[model samples]
Target chain A: MKGPAISIQDLHVSYYGNEAVKGVSLSVETGNLVGIIGPNGAGKSTFLKAMLNLIPKDKGDVKVMGRTIKEVRKRIAYVPQRNDIDWDFPITVLDAVLIGTYPHLKLFRRPKKKDKEWAMQCLQRVGMQDFSKRQIGELSGGQQQRVFLARALAQQADLFFLDEPFVGVDVSSEETIVKILKELCRQGKTVIVVHHDLSKANDYFNQLILLNKELIGFGTVEEVFKPEVIKKAYKGQFAFMNEIGVSL
Target chain B: MAFIEAVMQYGFLQKALLTSVMVGIICGVIGCFIILRGMALMGDAISHAVLPGVAISYMLGINFFFGAVFSGVLTAIAIGFVSQNSRIKHDTSIGIMFTAAFASGIIIITMLKSSTDLYHILFGNVLAVRSSDMWITLGISLIVIAAVYLFYKELLVTSFDETMAAAYGLPVRFIHYFLMTLLTMVTVASLQTVGIVLVVAMLITPAAAAYLLTERLWVMIFLAAGIGVVSSIVGLYFSFTYNLASGATIVMAATSIFVLVFLFSPKHGLVWKTLRVKKKRASLV
Candidate 1:
């Protein structure tokens, strides 16, 4: 709510000598739901990963909450693409959510009873408390996504980063996740999502980061959703966005 | 009863029993992570790759433990290096490197035709296990147990999702190498009981069977260790009584348990799934 919660200066990322994300500079204020949208190969995931320090960045200075990622890592919570992990792993839902408390606990220390109650509360927020004992593999895609949200909520961080969280999610689950993210924002948290659904970008987030290897626009949804900006970022590949009947 | 009597009658059989059970428990503990991380083949690779190390150690009149662990861990790191740095898939690298080390081991073993104990190193002869080997197995078992106990959270995160672990500032690569090191130590510790060749079965089968039967990792670990203990106990019985090859017998016992769980596990078994479908159909009709 004070300075920018996330600030990046000329960030760059590439894969194996090929440039994936180019010089992108932006500062996002806290307590807002922001969406990063682009085409399939627009490096949306790459940009988010680079910022989160999940992947190697060729060049950049990325800071969260006025500190380097390593210095303020405990305040950052990340939920990677659901499919990026093994769903069939033999882990119960509650146990998965308990992983969020790991960062707060000291090394070699187990999650205390209070942590369990807090995790349960996080699960309840996403309406997943009933399925706490269920194995994660048995859940529907939407339910799985909600559990991920619950885990993020349990992190109790000032910022959240989720990548393609709604890819296979059901409509109700999508609504639930957006509602929770908004609640986090209401609580003065910054939520950044790498979303591909151009249709729901306006509804789900207050700010939009249109990216395609470079920063095309970064501002309020109304201010940045211009036709030219969308076209420029999508490289004339805004056919689907047009079909959605946006003013852009 | 005869096997139990033999175990009571002979110190050698007692040592074999203790050593095999230790191998079983440690293998089961480590194998959960191995299989869960989808590195079951890495288990096999490290096991086989220890062959050359064992051969060199024997030739040099040293304990095979250090040499075997060195070769096994080195081969594991090399596989990761090749797969990571090049276009070669992990499995291909594993197949290439482990087999090369194993072949080198075979040649070295062949040249040392005077040593009758080397074949035991390959196929495992628990009866011939020495007191030093038992102590080493005990030590490795304690270390593996304590390590898993201490680092349960980190292991859970890394095994489930590496990116999330890295995001939390965990050293993902360090965890991988640490696991490979533990695996190499385990593979080496198991040499006298299951040996270099058949140790992978002990590592995989019990853990996999437990995975099918449980929904929690801690539960799976416990179940796996239990099954591993049972397999070794049963295996030693049959081997001691029938005069069969100990490693093969132990591996077969573990496999039989895995097959049973695959077909008849109460929760995730194929048979239960089919029966549930049939019951639903009958009710609908």
Candidate 2:
């Protein structure tokens, strides 16, 4: 609890002998809303997955709350990209959210009434309480995203990793998710998001981590949002945001 | 009523009926996961791959069920290893491994020159199942059913989203192999009733029909088991009445039910969907 919430040192990942994340090292303090922004295939998602040990890493050292990721896995929650989920999976909104409690329950134990009540509370937090009984496939894009957020909320995790949470979501859902994320941060939780839209990056995240197969910048938005850092990461395509005076 | 009475008169018929029903429930329950995970072909492959195990077990004078189950699990792991190690897709690996295993079984059976009646193993003679075979089937069925019951949530979570299961520290790889082992046991247990050639039908058709009828997994499983039991009972009756191959008759019965559901189910059937479209167009006009 005294050190950074998440600390990674000299991380390297390879896919079929080609390095995706190359010697990346960064630390995120607790209670910060951080955005990892990069272009396509920039290892932004790979970094998060490697730190979580979701994917195999060639070389890395990652610690959460001064302990190994596996040691404190129960305190961490992850929301995969929308594409990673199968919409046709035969589960209700409430069941999907209740999966968050599986880490706490024993192997043969079912979700108790208390677990169901807590899941309902989490669903209410994301305004998905009304859709708890609906089939997952029947929900709209925003509703689905909110359901996933509610699942993460059910975990009551101190650290959260969301991959492209705003993709295909409605404007209102996007606003709602960001508001909830800020609220989580205010509650002393560390939230890391794999984001693509640089225009809204400054407004959405208090901290910025610019990456492109390597660490380009890691600091507060005011420090890491320099025009040079953006140009370096996006290969000069994003220089217009600065010239247009968009306050990025 | 007379037909039922006549069929129930023979002890062999009673044994076959019990075995068929037991196989039906086990295959139907496990098949829900099989079809839901899009592993219908894997079920087919594993079932076919068991033939060599049976042949080799007979040659070695051992329990053919153990041999068949072992071979089925080996085939599953081999398929996984090939797909994971090489560029070949999973289906292709299944195709390669199962075909080779099946061909080897055929060769082994042909070379043995024994009075083993390989035809019974291939096509199944459910009426010929002895009391020992019945007990083995019962034990396997109970284990499979119990495993499914105790680990239903883990199986659902893993089959639905493997990455999330691993993130939750659910030992995903172990669960996967365990499921494969259960599938093998189910396949072996079903061999006496449905035979190698038609076992996959028992593993897929009823479950798929159930999937078409329900929006919930538990409902799908129960529906699948119901469909499987009905198919077994009806198919057994037809086989008795017409003096037909029991395994083929059972498969046809299950397929007929699937066809009916595919065309006429109220929610997802093609006919209802087309009718709804036409009604909407008429209203617009």
Candidate 3:
């Protein structure tokens, strides 16, 4: 009765010139929280971009809930890395979150009353309701991350793709985001996050996809976090275990 | 007294005054966003680019306004497309386009052998503002202001973090083009009042001054518009009394206000803050 929420078959992606992801096939089941961990330049961000159709994939088939990406695009939400934003922009937190509803609005139609209500609820869910009126430039790093999470929540999607959501988040923001993502999984939504930290990977994710410009492993965290898989994924560039203690 | 009444009573003067007011308000309003989006330089290039269209239209004996709008919009779209696709930097693209357009206008004007002076294009004669020009300015300004208010959030979101906004499904590309189109329209409409050379002063100064005063977008727009109107009136008065160029005078007035705000504004202002800091350190010692 259960089916995969997100399925990618023979996905291929390239940057300006070189191929980054080649023949990568994977499927994420519904109601699962999947952590995609990889070293720097390991195609983690590229994979998410390809899935979102942000970048054109050289070759692949991507589907959501057994439907092609085009059919289910409105049911997917994304949160990119926080550092990719210009902090000096002139907008309030509420305004930023309100953007999540723009895709559904008719061309040239302004945000309706119900849109504002839904946005406010999402902000409240992220515990950023108090700062809704504040200009985004004034928020702290963690608060800004929370606002982004709130915007994603406003999309009301069944599948969420987060690119390094906790990259620079403070402890509180990290905890808050983890809690929200876990709650989404509990509610039968599929949550896929591109994460870097190896220590908390097992604790936060039920399933794992270890990548290093290749699909090193994809399975339950217990089955995929073996020493050999970790070594291949991290490339022994540094002794992560001694620095942060055992792989998750 | 009879001469004074004669000049003041002219219908053209009335229209010019109204046109200048509308142009000032619209530029002050849209220019705030332009400055915040870091496109003041782009706006400068776009204003100059309108000249070629004006000259070409004159050569073809067509409506000059239509020519300017057509050329300005085309230039805006070209710049946008090229800047995104080419390896060159955005400023470089703008610079290249600006020179090409300016040179084209000069060559066209020289070829046409028209009696219309370059000063009328470069510096603008506010005294010559006509009823048709006023109507065009008012019409475009209203549309610009309405669009801005309706999509304030979307524009701000895209301007701030385009990639993130796109990820959040905000149609970032659409808003980017939309904003650029508005900026081009505003620049084209303002050419009659401030001219290209000095129009940027009006476009940038008020917003820059407002920036030093507050971090809020709406507040900055309001303050900038107020400053623009006051400077326009003062500049007009000065030009009338001194028998100087009205457009240049208006631009100079705006620049002078910016200088004042830069020096005397309380927070982040250049002059008063420096003195205050020195006084505090002296007291502490």
Candidate 4:
């Protein structure tokens, strides 16, 4: 971990007159795989949205790679937590993967051969190359998550914000995503994941940003994920966290 | 010999037949997108909303098609803008826009000093379909079909998961607005042949029947077109024999087909699934 890749200062997020994320601030280093662990309704998702400026913040500043988020939009990729899409829609998986290249492609210019090849490569990375021509509805939950990851891969950005990528996914898919994240960090790309499982924290991420609406702590897994901070962040919750201490 | 003589007798009947087949093809291709995207109600709303556009165009004494296109797309854009800005959902926005458009059409019709040409807007007197309207519908439908074929993949992704598509750098916002505009155009063009009330049946029923039959997109589109042509031809024959409105009869026929398919489709049909379950239980016993 070196200089900060993402800087957050006094961030606050509210929804429909209720504050979900109170004042929070943290800086994340470049190429660090960060895990956010908190109890349910602890504003984890809200904080993630605020980081990307996807949701309106009451008062805050988020700078990615020393520039404002809007200025560095192309360098950042976001995969939403809950996507309420119409599943039976008429499109092949290849079409869905191709969309990941939209931000880089010129407006009004159709996708060229190189763009198609990139889409295929991303799907291949996710091991979904065989399902490229399959209908989206035919895919299982884990397969769908892989496609989502493939979309992010297509972006080829420096920073990726993923909201709960492992939820409802199969073991193989989870391992595949973890491997991909590791590869991403190796390539000097930062990956921020909103993870629910505390047991897998140490195994998945080197840096831990513990929170419960407020920033409890942010450091390496060894430094920040102590018993004291874990209790404060997820007190009276996570029976599994008590049974197994950060090793699943 | 008698049937051949009847076919050769009147040019109007031949024109009407050709018009129905062309419109059938257009509806079949477009309606597949509508069904898959769950915009079946959007198509319905646009058909009803085109009424005022037609009535106002008729009063202006200009190309009615142009008037319909302008008004229909305007209503669509308005709906899109309002829904995006407001907290209201897409369905609610559609309902509000559809009612307002319909009311405006009624007011305009009542204000016109001339006698109510209600049939032109409501039932679409196929007997009165001019060569001019035919040319317009044909040209616009061809363009729309061609566009759909070209951007087949983009339309699918946006329809399935808009946010993911947007994040991936797809112009989801543009596609959303473009889809509504195209739908409005299709509705306006078909208004003369099918009327505001029956155009929905033309847009929805064929695709719905196709949905019951297949999960494949290409197959659904083909099936929808086949059903549309059958309904149009059979209904036209019935209308000619019984002195009924051709458009109304065609929609009724399509509705009947929908009911039949919905009841008896092998996989997802109501009757087959029920009976199959019962048979499985019986075998277990």
Candidate 5:
């Protein structure tokens, strides 16, 4: 609560003796729409998971809201990639969102009417109120992503981590998601996204953390979105674009 | 009607019938989760692993139920440990542990030359179920059903998305082990009636049919139970009248129902989907 909203120091993660996320350090302030852009297999998703303590970190110091991750885990929400979910699972959209409140409920107690109402409200926020009763498999890819966002919203978390939220999503759903994310930032919540598209990165995030297995730059869009930094992070593969003034 | 009357005249027949119904309901309930999680092979492994436990229990002159449950749980843990600690995949782990345990059981039986019939344990003799076995089946069924009812949501979430469950701070590991323990208990309770060879069918076929019929978890569960009970009753009647192997007859009954649902269920059945496709093509023409 005093320092940055999220602080990572000397974070290192490995899988099968191969380093996935090299030693990295960064700090993010509260209310920042931070985009973590990197090449494929550059540990963008691994870094987010490491920060949340979802995966084992070989060496790292991660603190959220000036507190250790364990102390504030309940205050954090994560929307994993769509590929990690079972699309054919037999659950309604409302039931899926209501799972977010499971941390607050007592054991052996079912979700009450008020909890259902709150879940409906979260669905409404994501423009999925009409589809709450439908099974998850019946929805299109974009609607499914929106439903996942609604689940995150139902958590009422102050810190949100989304991995590839726009992949395979329709344009309208992507816009709706961006609008809701900006809204969350306006409400003083920190939203960190693992983004891929470089063209819309400037318009989407106020702060950008360019990474390629290591921290390349962490600053505002104007400060960090430079030609030299983009070229270095993408290993000189970024083509020069006159519109964004950077070649990512 | 006369055949039913003649079958019901014996006390052993009455006990066996009750045991069949109880086994049917319990297996049906647990089978829904098994098939949903794609753990049908795991169910097969645990059931097979119980053979050694039964042999050992007979050697020690203890309750075979305890031995069978212990062996089943030990197999589950071994599978989990092997898969987690090594590069061996889950299916491979299951295959290794179950075959080894089953082999050990056979060896022990042969070495001891125990008079306890191994054939009965392997293929089951449902008509031979004693009153005590019926009581044990009843108690285990009650416990399994209650556990499923109490932790339905937690189990549902964990089975659906384990990561989300862990993120929500639910004791996912504990839930997993507890579910494994319940699976073992059910497997052990069912051993006397269905035997090792056919137990997996009892745990899978009815639930699979129900899965084809319904889209909701609770509905699938209830429908599975209904299918299991009906199959058990009909199979028992046929076994009584025709003097066939009761366990095999019951499994065949469940399989018949599954085939019917697979072909004819209005929502997800193969026939309907094919018909719908043909109709659309015809309309285009």
Candidate 6:
């Protein structure tokens, strides 16, 4: 429980014999906002899923809070990609957030009023308490993302995994989500985000993980956010950097 | 007046009414999860797949409910296993399993009993309901209601977002199979009223209509159950009065309600959408 919040050693994944993530090993300590960054199809999401064991790993070991995932699953929370779920489902924002409390409850037990209060607080943190009574499908993309974040928060998890939280999200909601995730880190929770926008990476996370189907770089923003490293991971396709100015 | 008098005077008529209503309610309740999970075709497959069990039960001289449930559950599991373990999609597996089971059932039933018995199983004859069949339907109804009531959140989460459910360490596969089992039971219970061919109508139409009426699952369940109960009552009334086939009448009733909701429900209806558009144009003018 005292070691790195997440530790993965030589993680590997494959689909149809083609490697997706090949030998990814990193140690992320507690109480930091970490970002996983790479070009598209670099297996950034694959690494997270492999770590969570949401998918099978050809070879790897992941330890969260010095414990195996199966042993400490309750202490973990995951916000899957926006497209992973049916947004048209007949669920209110509050009810969706209340799912966060499920892991802590006994089987066949509904969320109590106290848990409802906590779920509301989580929604309040993301500035979405006003929409608690609304159905999720009526919300904008950003609002939907925030609802998912609020759901994750209701878990009161020590380690968080968010996959592409900003894809298709409105700008203000993305800003709001980043603020809440940083605040969670300050409150001693480890937050991991799979983010694609390299321009915002330097400002968003204290710890950076540069992945390209492998661990290209893993360290502080100053140590690994270099243009050379980005080029190596992106296979020297830095032309996009010319458009966005790399922001460093 | 005649229908009401018939219902009160004849014990068998009362039993038929009760059985269909129970079938209606459970189908609506369980169908909410089924549609929400995008397993409507699976519902169809299970309903048809129960035919083999009915045929086997007839052969063995045993109650058909157990045989029906056994065959339905087995078909459900087989569909799941084939889909999960192979490149074939769920719809493909469902098509294969249901047809095979249904054909075998027809062959066996035609060989064992006269075609008249086969006609009743395929088309249903609620007016001939027996005491034991009614009791079995009641028991299964209670179990479905209790299971849904106790595990509302679990079912909701799993149905809406399976990955999140798995992340919470809920047994996602177990829940899937558990739902399949409940679906089979509901399908089996509906045998005497809707028959295997039209049981999927009771299972899907009411729930889908309710889906357009509300955005909350609890409200959807209640609305669907209400719709189902009404359909059963109306279908039975017409069937008894006109000497029509009960199964077809019940399915038609449910489908008619679904059509009305599709056109006129407040939020997701075609009429409402058109009305809102017209209102916006008027304001611009």
Query: What lDDT does candidate 2 reach at residue B156?
Result: 91
Q: B1-285, model 2: which lDDT tens digit per residue?
A: 765797668888889999999999999999999988999999999999998999999999999988898889899999999998888999999999999999999999999975356787777888898998899989998999899999998999898878777776778889888998999888888888888889999999999999889888999999999899999998888888888888999999999999999999888999999999999999999
What does candidate 6's lDDT look like per residue over A59-168, in tens digits? 98999899899888999999999888898899899999998999899978888999999999999989999999999988999999999999998998999999999999
- Write one digit per residue (lDDT tens) for candidate 2, span A159-189: 9999999999999999999999999999999
Candidate 4 lDDT over residue span B1-285, tens digit each: 443355479777776776777777778778888877778888888878877877788788877677777777778787787887879899999999988998888888878854447657787777566787678778877888877777766775566666555544466668866776777777766676677888878888998999888766668888998998888777777667677888888888888999999999886799999999999999999
Candidate 4 local lDDT, A122-185, one digit each (tens): 9999999999988777898788888878988987888898999888889999899899999999
List of clashing residue pairs for candidate 1: none
Candidate 5 segments whose C-alpha is farther than 4 A from its true place: A236-248
Q: Tens digit of lDDT per residue, candidate 1, span B1-285?
A: 778888889999999999999899999999999999999999999999998998899899998888988998889888988988888998999999999999999889889884566778878999888899899999999999999999999999999978878887899899898999899999998888987889999999999999999889999999999999999999988898889999989999999999999999999899999999999999999
Model 5 C-alpha lDDT per residue in residues B161-191, reported as the tens digit of each score: 7777776566787887888788888888777
* Cα error, candidate 5, residue A41 (Å): 0.9
Would you list the clashing residue pairs of candidate 5? A1-A65
Greater-DockQ candidate between 1 and 4: 1
Candidate 4 stretches greater than 4 Å from native: A1-13, A22-25, A47-83, A91-135, A154-158, A231-248, B1-8, B77-87, B113-116, B213-219, B222-226, B256-285
**Model 3 lDDT per residue over A191-223, tens place:** 999997787899999999998877899999999
| Sort order, DockQ high to low | 1, 6, 2, 5, 3, 4
Candidate 4 lDDT for residue B163: 57
Q: What is the lDDT of residue A172 in candidate 5?
A: 98
Q: TM-scores of the models, in the given order?
A: 0.97, 0.96, 0.88, 0.83, 0.95, 0.96
The CAPRI classification for model 6 reads as: medium
- lDDT for predicted candidate 5 compared with the true structure: 0.88
Model 4 clash number: 1
Docking class of 5: medium
